[model samples]
Target chain A: MSLINIFSDYTLRTVALGSALLGAISGVIGTYTVLRKQSLVGDAVSHAALPGIGIAFLLTGSKNIEWLLLGAFISGWLSLYIVNSIIKNSKVKYDSALGMILSVFFGLGLVILTYIQKIPDSNQAGLEGFLFGQASTLLKRDVIVMSIVGGAIIIIIALLWKEFKLLSFDPEFCQVSGFPKEKLDLILTTLIVIAIVTGLQTVGVVLMSDMIIAPAVSARQWTDKLSVMVILSSIFGGLSGVIGTIISSSTRNLPTGPVIVVIISAISIISLFIAPGRGIIWRRMRDKKNKKRLNRNIILNSIYNLNIEGNRIQGYSLEDLSISKGDFNFPINTIEKELEKLETLDLVKGKDEKWYITEKGINEIEDFRGRLEE
Target chain B: MNVQIEIQLIAIVVALACSTLGVFLILRKMAMMADAIGHTILFGIVVAFFITHDLNSPLLIIGAALTGTLTVFLVESINKTKLVSEDSSIGLIFPLLFSIGVILISLYAGDVHLDTDAVLLGEIAFAPFNRFVVNGVDIGPSSLYIMGAILIMNIVYVSVFYKELKISTFDPNLAMALGISPGIMHYSLMTLVSLTAVGAFDAVGAILVVAFMVGPPTAAYLLTDDLKDMIFLSGIIGTISVVLGYWTARIFDVAIAGMMAVMVGAIFLLIFLFAPDRGLLSIMRRKKRQKYDFAQISFLMHVINHEGAKDEREELGINTIHEHLGWNKEFVKDIFNNLYKSNLVYIEDDIIRITDKGRDLAISNAEEIVNGI
Candidate 1:
């Protein structure tokens, strides 16, 4: 398949559109989840939704995405509620609750699915698509349903932006200011559930969390403001959706969810390393530069002290500096390099093998000491 | 032994192995790490398999366990950078690794015996068919022996280092002060988790291993305060789930591992709701009882404080006392009635007076409150 085929092909277009919409919705909701440190809650909810899907199929005897998703939404919401209750009611830790609920619900789901498999009906064939997601099987109608639901979620988020922002950043203040913190939390959690449910067809249960987490994490590296972060995260998510779709479609034996996960992970890693201000690479580079400047100053200050101690203006060898430095493990080569750098700054002048501190170097030391005292 | 008995034995051993270590994982708040390791170890097995080209090689278990510890190291490193929170760090690392594992399995589906379904939902029913043989003499199923050995290993490890593990888990700083390296204990525990996960994977699959590990221990945590009791109770819970889950699956003709997981959840829900002291129902009941007790104590203290004072008539009048206490009239009346029935306070000439017993109780309660106990 070629690039143009992605648009011209009907199935590919619907799949791409569905994946992109799913990505954008999850990305927007993910910003709040990640900021609130509820990232793994998405993981638990997605896994917990599996049993609901299986039960829905069992009860309805049909594979209608709507009914299945409704079931998914209920159970996913229920799982989050139970998790919250566990934390509030017992000594069980958050991670333990999350892991236990996630696995047990998923286990129940497998039981239902297997029971369905023994039902002797071929309709159960495609139901397993929810496990790893069959993005290629997404129909036009499914995309339309996703769009309408996704549009409603986006609207709700816009209307509740202030409350949601306050809830995410400072729930105590949100409570103190007369907002119903519990109700707001329920609404936020519901929205997160809907986002995970919408993307389940494309990303599946096992890997759906990356859809909610990676985009926000990547976008977070690029900006500090919530609005920009939200927009950037959605864009990263939507772009990965399209790109992953095209790549997966063009290849053989590639699942769209994992491929997209790999791509977004790449983006997150890149952002972590190269983004300005918070980027690891930039921080490391800045630290290196600061250390170099500090080393240069230390060498300059030492030469000034040696001159004052000798009570004479004289050149000194590298050995003299090393002797004065005592047990400080500044390597001999590093000291030599600092002296050469000082000579270039005109802070020191070296003739033959001995180095002498210039007047500028002496004044620099005095100024540093004056600033320190002040 | 028959196939049914063999499968149940394998599951029982797997559950025991998981729940033994699960107590520490939950206590240390690293239960999700078990979930992460459960998934990421698949990547380790795949890499090791690709190298050894043998499914039963000991190197696979070693490699997978190493990968599990590596997952912890990576998550902690990302957490150290403070670029992402710990939960997101976990959420990020495992999927990427698991996805790679899945993609690899799919890409080489012909060469590898592993399938994505088996990775997520294992086929434990087939365990009996893979019989272990030595010198042409058939022993029990290979997984039965494998899981049995792992269970013994876990028991030995926990019993030998029970003190160290207990101290380190409850208070890492104290453990450090006592010259026990929390880091070593953590890594060693993670290594065992990985080993147990790999062994259990052949029986319960990657995902359900988390159920076996977290569900029983968490439910047991609700039922017991003692660490030793919690560990023992979780193992018992795991055993019950395995036996019941096996029979339930047999009757319903469904997946055994999945039913076992469901059983674990069901048992947990029961304990969560109905455990004697720490359960939700009891906690709510305690809260209600404490509310009335606190209100009655405050009422008695008020009467004692105003006894024979100049404002006693004005302050201790039942109708106006509600106003002073800022409580609803009906609630105040209810508390007053209860206090009068208990002989703690009596109304005479419309002024409430505290009895000697009530005065003693009120003074001691006030002292306790003042002492911050």
Candidate 2:
């Protein structure tokens, strides 16, 4: 489909809208989850929800999205509760608890799914979609349900913004200030569970975590403030959702969830490399420039020091400068190149193959020393 | 052997291999790295498959090990940059690689023998049929042998490097000071984890391999403090889960690997709730007993301090003593009765008094508390 056809196509529109809603909600909640250093919780919760979906189908014997997701929400929350209890009560570490619960819960889900397949007249055709999500199968009603849930989550986040912020940054301070830390934590966790469940239909179990973590991580590279990070993260998430849905829908045999994951991963990688301030490439460039400037200053200062030692306005050959002085070693070509650049800056004067420090060069050396002393 | 026995053997071997290394993983706090490696190795297998065009090629194992090490390298490098936290780095890298693998499978490998469902939810029921043929005779299930070799390899690795792994896990700086490189230990262990994961993947799928790797060890951690006991206990737990899960899956006609993972979780839950020293119930019971003992000590100390005071009558009166101690009347009465039964305190002229035993205990406790011991 072309760009305009994406909006004009009914199935594409529904999938895109549902995916965007899922992405935005997860993005907003993921900011807090990532900030709280619980990024992998989404992975565990999503995996755990698989069993819930199967159990829900078994009990209700229908493919109602609402019932299925409610089942997902409950079980996902239960897994998180179990993980926290295990961490708090035993010698088991957090990652072990997460990995254990995630895999075991998913195993149970698979068992239930296989059992469902065995049942006569079960109509289990669509259940496998939860494994590797089938966004192309999303209908109008699913999008409606997603929006309603997504809207409520956004509103809840807005109402509890201050509490969530305090809880994320400093739970101890929030608790000391008479806030119910446990209850607030439960609320935040529940909100996160809801977000993950809502996105499960779009992204599935295995890749749902990237939806939660990638956008927030990308947005974090661009900004330090919580609000900006949250907003930028949601925008990045929503755009990836729409773009991924479009790409997957246009292609043959491309699963929407993984494609969406690929898009978000690309965005995260690009943000890591190119975002200002914290970007890796920018930091590297800045470091390189600083090193170059430092080298130039060292060469200038050395010329001034050699002239002072000789107690005469004498020039030094490139050979003299290339020799290691006080552990400062530079290649002969590097020394020559730096001298030429310094001469252009009027800091040094080069005649033939020899170099002499100018009056400005001496003043610059004195200024650098004075600054260093202060 | 029968298919049932062969399948169970494969599972048992897979579990043993995973749980043994899992002990080190949890100790080094890299259990989730196992989860990451489990997923990303699929990308490696897919790439290796494309090169060899054969599913049974040994090069796949090398590719998986390399990919697992690469995942660790990338995560650490990203973490070293301080751009993202460690968890986020893990969450970021694996899914991307796994997605590429999934997409590749869907696109080009569609007609191949590779199945995504088999990769994610391995059908161990079919594992027994993949016989390892030697000359003209069959030598049991191929996965059983593969997993058996991997299990022995894990046992040998752990035993050979026990001291190094222990020192590095508990104290990396000390390991470094002792001239053992923790980085080498870390990457080698990661390589081993990937190897075990790939070997187990055919029998238990990608995600359930994590259950095998993490579940038993976590349960064993609750049962013991010694590393040797932990390793032994986790292996035992893994074996029990494999046997029980196989039988249960047979009875219900369900997915065997899934049932095995569930069994692992259930065993871990049981140990978490009922283990002798570290169980939740025992910990709570210990806290309750400590509370009562602390209360009794405070009661004895209070009576001893006021035994010969100017306001002894006002402070030591039975009705007033509860008020002086800032405790409710009923709780104070219960504490006094318990202390009286223990012969630590006595009632004289309706005033509380401390016996010599109580006085001695109170002085020692006070000194210990004041000394911050």
Candidate 3:
């Protein structure tokens, strides 16, 4: 099918737009989560939201998105509050509290879900889908609501960018400067809660954390500034949404949330390996070049040191140097390779089976030695 | 044995193993790793099934354990990049791997009995029916044997390495200096955690593994400071929750694993609110008592400081005392009345008088506070 035909499908279009908005908003707000090292808290809150959604359905006997999301937001916030209290008041660490809350809430949600499934005429078919999300089954109205929610989250993040940035980079400074650090932290967490609640429909609880982390990490590879990173992350997140939607729609039985997660992870893995200075591949390449230069300098300095008394010893063989420089213990082939490189740089020349230092090599070695002595 | 009894036995064993292993995980701050390993084991099972083509193969357990360790290795590698925090690295790897497993099941194994729902929340009721028979004779349920072995393994692992684990968990640098290899202990403990997690998977499913692993230990942690006591208490708490959870599930006709997990949280909540030293109620009561003590002492000091002053203007009456201390009238009256009843002060009509007991109490209290400082 053509792009036009794909976009013409109502369900596909709704899912694509809904997930796109979800991704963008998650990426934008999740930058703080990633920076503040609260990425897994998103996972906890999302899982914790499940029971609340189930309870909301049981009480209202409806599948209304707004009511379910409201329930999710309240419970998600409650779980976070519990986590904060646990960390502050006890010897339990942060991750343990997060893990404890996550599992207990999700288990409670499972009980509620199983109970709700048994209730007659409950319309709870779609409730289980929240575990892994079912964006492909989203309706146009749901999409509209998600977009509005996503838009509001984006606006809040934008309006408080400076404060959030200050808080992320130097929270102590922000607090010392008389900023309401606690209130700002609450606002940031609430925004994260909003993002997770909104994205719950698209990615589900189990996979929602990836939507927050992958894009922010991928964006972090390409920039140092917070603003640039946030923008790039949102773009990457939105792109993954489009790609995942297209793939899931194309393939039967492939879920949208996991597919989106796979696509975003691919993007992140690619960015981690090949993106400019920060990428692992580039760092490896830079290290290789620096090591090669270091090898050449060591071999050249060793040759200079061998004839320190101005008794010019010409054409020192690779074996002689390897033996004399037992501390470096460089192999014969390694010495030969460095010698070849020195010859190419015109610092040394080879004549019949021996290496001779050129006039330029003498001056360069003297200059390095003078600097070292100084 | 009755299937219900057998199932409850498996739950007890599973809880014992998970709670014991969970103490170490929580101490190492790797509590969330239960969640990570829990989900990643699905990928391991799927891959093992793909390779061996047998869901019942013992290799699946090893495969799951290996993949659980692999998950740890990958999370560490990503963390070493310094590009993302440890939590983000965990967030990054598991979903992608878990998604692959879910997608694989949906695409190819849909017709099989391998339901994602079953993986998340195992059917403990049917666990007994999936029994292990030896040479035409009936043994107990397969889960009972599996969980029994894991429980034994956890017991032995903890006992054998109790000192090393304690030293490493408390101080890795010291362990390293002593050549104890905290890294080896960590990986081995994680492997044990993965093994316990998989053994309990067929009984309590994945997510509740975390609840069992974290909840009981945390409850025990609130009650005791000794590591050995914490382990024993956690085991006791886990067993209680499983028994209570089984009865509740039977009564309510709900998911057994879910009820057990809920029970774990409920027990933790009870301990959190009522434990002797660290419970929330105890903490709040201490604060309340301290506030009362502070108020009483300050009130006594005020009355004593003003009594028999050379300047008549400095004299304090019952009405003037409340204004000077900036306390409410009722509160001041309550304090004054209590002091009067105790013979700490005698309110002579309008002016307050300090008795000998009050002076001795104030002087001794001040000296005690000074010595404390």
Please give, for residues B322-341, the per-residue lDDT of candidate 1 as tens digits: 88888999999999888778
Better of 1 and 3 by DockQ: 1
**lDDT of each residue in A219-310, candidate 2, tens digit only:** 99999999999999999899999999999988899899999999999999999999998899999999999999999988887887788788
Q: Answer with 1 or 3, whichever has the higher lDDT.
A: 1
The best candidate in terms of DockQ: 2
Q: Candidate 1 has which clashing residue pairs, if any?
A: none
Deviating ranges (above 4 Å) for candidate 1: A120-122, A307-317, A325-333, A352-354, A366-374, B51-54, B305-334
Taken over the whole model, the C-alpha lDDT of each candidate is 0.90, 0.90, 0.86
Which digits, one per residue and each the tens of the lDDT, describe model 3 over residues A1-374?
44675568877888888888888988898788998888898889999999999989988888989999999998999999998988787777888888888888988888889888878887789998999999988888888898888788778878888888999999999999988999999999998998899899888988898898899999999999999999999999998998898888888888889899999999999999998999999999999999888788788888777766445866777776787743676888989988998999998888887777888888888887788799
Instruction: State the weakest 10-residue window (summed lDDT) of model 1 chain A.
Output: A323-332
For candidate 3 chain A, the 10 contiguous residues with the lowest summed lDDT are: A306-315
* Residue B274 shift from truth in candidate 2, angstroms: 1.3
Query: Measured by TM-score, how close is model 3 to the native structure?
Result: 0.92
Question: What CAPRI class is candidate 1?
Answer: high
Collision pairs in model 3: none
When 1 and 3 are scored with TM-score, the better candidate is 1
